[model samples]
Structures are given as structure tokens and as C-alpha cells.
Target: MSVLPDPGASRAVLVGTSQYEHLEQLPAVSNNVQALADLLRGPLSLQLPDRHVTAVENPVAAHAVLGELRRAATEASDTLIVYFAGHGLVDAQDQLVLALPHTEFGRIETGLPYDWVRQVLLLDSRAERHVVILDCCYSGLALGRMSAGTGLADQAAVEGSFLLAAAAETRTALAPVGETYTAFTGALLEALRQGIPSGPALVDLGTLYRHLRLTMEARGHPVPQARDRNSAARVALGRNHANLPAWPVAAAAVADAPAGPDERPWPDPRAIRTVTGFLTALADVRVVSGLTQKAVSGRSAGSMTAGTVGRLLNRPDLPATWGTTAVYLSACGVPDEQITHWQAAWQRLRTQSAPAEAARPAATRDGGSGKPRVWQRPMSTFRRRRDH
Candidate 1:
């Protein structure tokens, strides 16, 4: 019994600092912020508009940190989510402070106060729900009792607010030595992408919190803490992917296959049946390899220029020759064996279309009296180029 957020109305500001001046650098924090942003925008996940999500990473100044939060808070009318994954400091007054790239431990003033983040939402935001996720040391300090100067456990909490902290008041969050994301954010992403089994169709904050806590505890990681007020925990975060229908066997195999050691996800070429399909798959391989047009040209030793790569990807017709296609794939780091698969697919598609192409008319040179019967070289622009 939950609903997805209105994609146009919700706003999210993801902030994380991976580099530090006085404290140890957290390289995984940047990954956390980026991966979360991708999950929030991906069509398979939260389905939020790309523009509605903002990511601020490794800020050197507090202004940049507060500026994005203030903007997102002011704009959001449905749900406002502020996520911070970096160092959390407790000042002399025991207030939660978010560390920046240039933050110094002795000079806590250089960091942004968690209270300022709350005030921005409380005072400026018209959002119906406010969700704050903090993944840092002593982040739970932002949600404890407000006993004199024992640190305001979220002083003046918003009417409908949910604050999730990665660690308890005296604990430190952990970033595993070889992980891409910090422990807390990593688990959070997993829940969003993997979904909760035996859960409802839509995943609300309450379910997500349960999954996070249990999963982390089972893995011997820090168990997160949550302070939900006025049923803010009921707000749906995203659809439960686990409850979605399963993919077909063929599709599942392709989707689940791991990338090669080079991090290239060379697609299976057996599925391609048309010029468009073949080229589209080839373009996808280039994208997966993280190769730019210029990079491809350079990698291919200038056999394929950047301009040629750009045009080739956009063009619907097949390349002028097999050599062109092979060069492009080789530039994208496709193995010779895989390149052979692509070559076979390319030939099959061309041959399949050849009969229809052979009957097509050409320019009126002999008053169109004769069709490809007069001249035949596959009767395609791709073939015409080579003939000329």
C-alpha cells in the first residue's frame, strides 16, 4: 500500500566528499553519490526526472554544499531528500557537521552544520515529506534527544521528517577497503536496485530501513538508525524490482552476464537481424567500453577518425565495407573472436536484405526502364559507396 513519488515534484540533493585536507580521504564516497544519483534517475528504479536530482561531490566550500540543498529544498513540493555520505563531525556544542574537502578537524566551523540543512527544509521547503540520509561517523547525533548541550537530536524536526543515520552517536561508519561504495550507501543502493523479496510492490522508507538494518547486521557492518516522525517512513521511495515480472531466459542471460576484465560488455551479436540492430549493438559496445569518438579514432591508430565514428553511429545504413565495421569494433577493444561474431551478424543482415535491395530502383539513368537488373551490387548505399 504505497505509491511512487511524483517524478516532477520530488527533488533530491546527493552530497559526498571523497577527498580531504586534514582527515583521511574516502574515495568510496564519490562512488556512493554517483551510484545513488544514477539509481534515482534510471527508468528501472525511482523514475525521477534527470533534472530533479542534483549531485554535489567533493565540495571545497560550504557555500556550494548549502547552495544545492537550499535550492532543492525550495523547489521540492512533494518529497525533499538530502543525502550526505562523508565525514560527520561533532562540534564543541555537539552539533552534527558535514565535512567538506577542505574541512579541518580543529576548525569545525569550516564544515556545514546538519542543523542548517534541517532549517532550510523546515523554513523554506513546502515539501510534504523530508528525508535526510546521513552516512558518516556520529551521524545518529542528528536524531537523538535534545538534552541541554548533549547535541540536539534533530532540534525542531520538520513536521513530516525521516532521518536515517549510518552510525550511532559514538560510532564511526566504515568504508570497506576494496568496495566501490561505502558500506551504508552500498547497502542502500542494493535495496533500490535488487529490491526486497517477500515485500510489497512499492518499497517505502519503512521497508527500506528494515532491509538496510538487517542486511548490514548480517554482514557484520554498522547497523543504521532511523528517526521517523508523523509516518514519514510510509512514503514510497521506489518500485520493488524484486516483485516485477522475471525476464525471459534469453534476455536474463544477456542482462546478467558479467563484463570482461577490460570492463567491456561486448554484446552477443547473434540476436541482431537488421542493419539498425547491428549498428545499435555496435554503438552500445562503444558506450560500454567508455570510449569517446576521438578515443576510438586514436585507439584505431587513425584508421577511423572521430568524425567518421560520429557519422557511423548516427547512420542507419551499414558501413561501406566489413573492414570499416571491424576497425571500429577493434578500436572499442572487442576481442577478435567477438569481432568474428559481429562480422557474421553483419553479413547475415546484409544478405537477408540483399534480395529486396536487388529489386529496388536506382536513379533514372535509362529513364528507369531497367531496375537493379541493369546494375547490381547489392543496390544499397553501403554497397554503392564501395563500388564508387
Candidate 2:
């Protein structure tokens, strides 16, 4: 038997935004998030390691949640999981839109696009297992659509990383009867709790999709459908490497503090200089990495330039809320493992930084490292490897 390595490197970010004071607000969104947390931290907890879980509530810390998730992907972890419970919309072109906490007046200006999230997930180079379970309206966008536009029921298997959206783009994902669980989340919980038994089944992508549909229908709810469940059409971890300098340590000696109410605090003035210095280092890394052959190829026929990706990493402009990052990263294609890596790094740095001078006010910048950092790699000499 081929023994798979321990998934200790794996990490999950659960973003559940339930309260929306706006007209687009859906109360069940929060319920779905809480239920998902219970599922992961409860019965599914046994399947995952103890240290691999981080659950964020409401919209306050969504961006921080996403930054952490991005960091996790960069850590070269083997598995990354992201679960989101909220309202999902689509653009005029039928693309997906993940709504945030303060999304208001049905305006597209306040939403996060699906394409952004996809970019985030594609950042991880070492993840062998990636799963995104999004229980939102028209979430099928999370799973790339079939280019052929063939309506025939198709299936995809999960090898390294895969996504499971709550509903297909054409369908409206529904909420469950009790405990604010969405139909998709409810079915997923059932499958995780009783679906995966002590058996020899591989629990491949097809099986998981089938299980999800069967379990949902069995419970008398709308049947769950999956897009790009076929192994032929999944996300591939690319083989791009950069010769960038080592990551700088002690940026403002920043420390990651617990997510609490009114937690607005500033970094140490001393650490600010360090953060500025690291930002300079990151800028150089991006320039050199960009000069190299930075190419990204995925299972889907789409490819992105390393320079474009480097911009996503370095650009720090964000909404002034917690869940915005999670929503944005989910939209960006940033993987969950990478986010966890950053969270770990943030925590470590936070420990070395000064204490909270005041409540962390709502700001686009987290007052730490403003630049997105990445390793440098060339696009040349990047051949698809059948085995690592």
C-alpha cells in the first residue's frame, strides 16, 4: 500500500457570515458557517488533525482569515480546505460573486468576484489535497465549469486539490430546516459523519460527489450537483520555483492576536520600520521572480503569468472588514494551505511585536506587512511531473 503522508501540514479556514443589515442579507448564512464549524470541529475533527482548524465568525475578521489562508498555502502543506456559508451571486456574464458582510443595496461594487478566489487557490505549489466546500447561491463557479457546455452529467476525481460548491451555477442552493445549515453543508456533514466509514473505499472525487448527491436527496432536500468533479478537470499544483531571498523575519515584531470585538491595535513603531524593510525585500523578490520564467499551468486549460500573480501577492488594497479577505481570497483562487502558512507566520511575528496599543480599528491595511510575498521561480524548465 502506498502510504500517504500525514496531513498535519493541512489547514482549514471556515468563514461564516450570517448577519447582513442590508437588503441582500441572508440570516441563514451565519447558520451555515456555525454548522460548518461544528461539523469540522466536531465529528469531522477526528478525520483532521487538531492544529489544522481555524474558524472565523461574522464578517469582521474575514480579510484576516483570508490572509491566514494565503499564508497556509505558501507553507507547502499537503492539504488545504476552505468552507464558506453565505450569499453567492453571479455577474452579467454568469460568473460567480461571493457576497461579504457589508454588501449593500444589491450593488456589484460591494461584492467579491469568483475569479479572484480561484487565483488564490492556485498559489499553493505543494498541496496534494485541496477541497473547497462553498454553500452559496450559484456556487458552481467555485468548481470550474465545462468549456464544452455539454449538459451531460459528468464527474471529476480529486487527486491533489478539488472544490465542491453548494449548487451548480444554474441552481439556487438552499438552506436546511434546522440549525441554519444549508442543504449543501447539511449533506456534507452527513457524509463526513456517517458517509466515510472504516472501509477500503478511496473516497475519490466521483465517490464524494455521488455521496453528496445521494445523501442530500435521501434527506428529501434538493439534490446537490457538482461541477468539474471529473479528475480530468481539476486544479493542478504547478512546479514553479523562484530563487528569491529567504523570507524576512520580525516585521514590526508583529504578533497575531485572537479575533475579538473592538480589537483595533497598532504595531510597534520599531516593528513598523522592520515591516517597511521587509516590504522592500518583497518588492525585490517580485522583480526578480517576475524576471524569471514565471508560468502557472493548471488542470483546466487556463494559465497565468507569474508577474500577474506577484501583483496579487504584493497588492494590499482591501475592504475595511474582517471577512473581506476570506471573501476576496476565495474569489482569488488562493488555496487554504497557503492561507494557514501566513496565519502561522503572522502569529509567530505577532508574538515578537508589541502588545495592542488600542482596539484594532477597521482599516484596509492590517498595519503589518503591506506587501504580498512569494518565492521566485522561472517559467522555463517547468515540466509537468507525474510524481513528485
TM-score per candidate, in order? Answer: 0.59, 0.48
Candidate 1 C-alpha lDDT tens digits along 1-388 = 3445555567899999888777767788889998889988774455566888999999878889788888888887778888988877777776778878887775877898877877788788878888888887643233211112232335424557887777643433367666798888888888888889988766788889999989988987767777888888877776676875343223233334576654333555864545644665666666445566777777777798889888888775776479878888887777788889988887887788777766765543334454344354455855756488
Cα lDDT, all candidates: 0.72, 0.45
lDDT of 2 at 260: 44
Separate clash counts for every candidate: 1, 73
Task: Candidate 2: give its CA RMSD in angstroms.
Answer: 22.4
List model 2 lDDT by residue over 114-204, tens digit each. 5555566765435555666666654323321211112212222233445665554333335533445666676665555554543222234
Model 1 root mean square deviation, Cα atoms:
15.9
Candidate 1 pairs with clashing backbones: 144-153
**Candidate 1 weakest ten by summed lDDT:** 142-151
